[model samples]
Target chain A: MNFTRRFTLAGLLAVLLPVSATVAQVDSLPSWNSGSARQAIVDFVGRVTREGNPDFVPVPERIAVFDNDGTLWCEQPEYFQAAFALDSVKAMAPKHPEWKQQEPFKSFLAGDRTALAEQGEQALLTLVTAAHSGKPTDEFSKSVADWFSTARHPRFNRPYNELVYQPMVELLAYLRVSGFKTFIVSGGGVEFMRVWAEKAYGIPPEQVVGSSGVTQYQLDAAGKPSLLKTAKVQFIDDGPGKPSGINMMIGRRPILAFGNSDGDHQMLQWTMAGSGARFAGLVHHTDEVREYAYDRQSKVGKLDEAWDEARAKGWTIVDMKQDWKTIFREKP
Target chain B: MNFTRRFTLAGLLAVLLPVSATVAQVDSLPSWNSGSARQAIVDFVGRVTREGNPDFVPVPERIAVFDNDGTLWCEQPEYFQAAFALDSVKAMAPKHPEWKQQEPFKSFLAGDRTALAEQGEQALLTLVTAAHSGKPTDEFSKSVADWFSTARHPRFNRPYNELVYQPMVELLAYLRVSGFKTFIVSGGGVEFMRVWAEKAYGIPPEQVVGSSGVTQYQLDAAGKPSLLKTAKVQFIDDGPGKPSGINMMIGRRPILAFGNSDGDHQMLQWTMAGSGARFAGLVHHTDEVREYAYDRQSKVGKLDEAWDEARAKGWTIVDMKQDWKTIFREKP
Candidate 1:
């Protein structure tokens, strides 16, 4: 063949190459540095998705459950949902005048973290219930959506949605392209997460399994049906509850599970225990310069037990400092 | 044009036509007689699916929920789940000899419907809980699946899975083809229904929302995580709870809802009350020959309030005897 003909053929091949081939050619996990952690994920997905392979999983059974907080986004300093709840409390303080003098409320309003923590879990729960409930479900969802659109992360000074991990976002999209259905199973409030999960993680509200409060079906004065938010705590989707939540909500065993803390240990264990090819991964937030670094002793997203378990079980532990070339999403 | 050319053009048109157009040209609802009820469904689906139209709803919002028992299948003898529970109680009778003397269990096992009914809801619940719980969730699912495969309906002498309404099955597929996500929202055990709903109704386990007992995550002696069934009663996805269950499970308001009894009244109400074009339908069991007929006076699947509401609200009421060309699915 002539040189011009060869060059024309090569140009056509480059243009016509499949997206998967293109992705593979250019680092599939661009935000993730070339490391063992990235390689492990790629290998697991390839094995499970390869047709006629022993590890081949049917498209319907390719379920991947991801923890929302530290795994998908930055949960450092304080959980983003907790911040939303605190902001909501401040917003509603004018209506509930008694909160000005209430035990947990006073400490919470004054930003006295130590005093609020000393008051215990029940007190904290009381403040959460007060701040989050006693409104229509749609109204709560609207408020959450509005908060996400405007609310900025304290440290980064960017919209909370923009603070999501770039590597994890790519992982979610990559799994989806491989015909896996990705879900967010978190310890965070289910309703709160549902508002932004679709836009943030490409997960629909129905695919989200998380902590939830009791909701009652009611009709307004005009007889329009509405789900009213009640103060009653329903299920806490954390720790052992993670698996139970997946069972109750998803009704299928996930093939892959990802999270960052002890709360997701059972979820990962559950995923790994299922028959056929499975994967369990943990994100170790070790990028102190780029992101807050804490493990084994951190108050927020403590990773001691899961860290040891991941190592013992040979599960993938993503070191943010070394494994990830980038942390938060880049501005468009 | 020449006759040969015209014939060839006609053949090409037939080959290129959509399945829906082909269905309409022949019979869209084969089991459903030409009637208002069938027309309503066709109209609603058509209006919402038509692109560039004012009534068009995006595919994501096309949620359709159906009641399981009397609506999807014949619930005449009893709810198939109830019969399964009774059989289960009898199967476990040797281990629990005390059940022979218990009020509900004794009546239930002896096949005394009147005596069991008089014993009240609490007694019935005890029998259900005893029959269903105290095993791992996967094991229970396996047992239920095995039962569905082997167990025959008392009167029909056919496997229970084969007893689903032919008209409804077609409707499910028809709606799905038009971008509707079909779901089975039942008052039966979620785990039990999850076993067969997919095979019987083409709805996946994830889309089946129903009454459930509490489940816990447990690591067995092998240290493998499993969801263990607990005897504690969680939520009953019936009556008003149907709407709440739909809200919590689906996270999206259904555009169309179908049911046959009072238990589904609120579900229909909720679906109808949602903004945008909506359709609510009830299957009236008016055929005594092909399938057993019972409505307001029936012990199981009482259709009193919903019947009245259907008339009052001008919702579609399917007269099973007149509307359906056939009832149960024809054997291959």
Candidate 2:
């Protein structure tokens, strides 16, 4: 109506913006570059959330699941949970002198990754059980919390929690704003993730479904009750287990799913197989400059099968180096 | 100024209120009688919700768990789930011709309760697995919904879903309004309860933790994925299993817990054992006229040891006859 000012687009945007802008900005995912990966996510969310659109899903059924490790954060040198476990093993070694002579334990305590790898999964599981179980749940949670507080990534030299992908964080927040319930369906231990997932990824403990050990209810002489974590592995929320875990926990088919490795193959399949406008994306670790680049050959977070599947299914492959404007939320 | 508007308390309230009242009213639990039972619930909620009070719990931590069967609805003669199971057996009997000659199946089909009871828990479990499992999760949910649509309690001749306790429903609403997250932690099948719990009790599917049989993920030729319910028993959410289920699903110890039988003993125990102001309540069925009153010797929902523990531990024992102004949410 009025041509009082000859303002450039940049000037207009600067004038319209707050001193410190938040998630309520026009560009919802600021950390994500203007790439096909970002566009795919934005388009999917818009189509499903549009009121009069044929693809519009009701708010209740709008469930989006994401795998934690390399999808949301770095899982390069080793999974952050594995680091915690190794730290735990070292911390508890004083209490058990027998571990010095034990096969897996001896190799593990000696920092012999080659020897540990040769021992296979069962040996690694033995180390995990010794490190993660046989304590009260509260104690286990506290230990996890403490580890997340102090433990730094071997490559990043930052707290494990701080290594979370900023673009993914924005995506989670964006999905949540569009009335989608975001859940962490990870291969990581549920107890470990519950301690910090909410703080890092904005997912509550109840919304997280992951591998877990059985916890027993114990009552003390003073009538106080506690859940004691046992050595038994109750459920593994990886690969095929993801779908079953989702059914057991969420009890509904998710419309959107994200992951970076083969561990997420089944979950993405389950999500995509649902009849409707569904979204599944794999975060390809191609950003060697900012993050570790590993695919088809990495010992941890092996991405071969899921990468092929994503391509075959036309699922969005987030070339991390090309797609993300930024990686970590915080600086080293 | 007020002298011109002299009015009785009822007249004042009437004039102050709208034509239709709702949860915003001063008396949060309108269906609850002015007894110690109601007062106990009110007082516990007040202390825990009031800001600046030392006993006040934060909103997120104000988790309330209620056992579904007798705690929230009628479990007389048999559990509503059991009734569903019987109807399912009859509906499925034609498909399985061998059931006519089978011991438990034959006794169940013939409606020989004495013989079925002689066959005991294992026999009943066989019937449950046969009736409930093997179909897709959604199909089983549909079957359960169909049964609920047609089925009614024999004593009251009302739809089974209509038999949810009015007082407890009001309590659930009241607690929810006071910053509490209400959850149904029941001995019933998780899948069965999830189908209706949201509409019936305002608890969402994810918030429900219960007994479950394992569900396997299946992908059809068309690439559509479905979760197929298997006959394998996964977890029992009764007695000690209740607390474990709570731990696994919720990952947080609830502050308030309600139950009506010994099956809920550990849940209530774990809840009360939490630090700070806590509430553990048992709905004592004492209204033989309005609803069946059975305890100690009753096979279904036997309230023996929990009855004694309630007295010993000073847990609120809701005398249904004295405490509830009404029974079911709707009349026959």
Across residues A105-191, which tens digit of lDDT does each residue of candidate 1 receive? 888888898998898988877877876799988899998988888889888899888889999999998887666889999999988
TM-score of chain A of 2: 0.90
Interface RMSD of 1: 10.1
User: What is the C-alpha lDDT profile of model 1 across B1-332, one tens digit per residue?
Assistant: 12353245433333344423533554446788888988888888777876556788877789999999999988869788877887788878889788778778788878898998798888877887887888899889888877777889988999888999999999997787666889999998888888888888889878889888888877779887777788987778999889888877788889999999999999999999888899999999988898988889999999998899899989999999999998998885
| Candidates 1 onward: DockQ, in order | 0.37, 0.34
Provide TM-scores for the models: 0.91, 0.91
Q: For candidate 2, lDDT tens digit of each residue in A28-80?
A: 78888897999899888878876567898887899999999999988878888
Residues B155-260, candidate 2, lDDT per residue (tens digit)?
8888898989988998997787676888899989988998888888888888888888888877889867788899988778889888888888887889999999
DockQ (model 2, Cα): 0.34
**Candidate 1 residue runs with Cα over 4 Å from true position:** A1-27, A110-115, B1-28, B100-118
Output the number of the lDDT-best candidate: 2
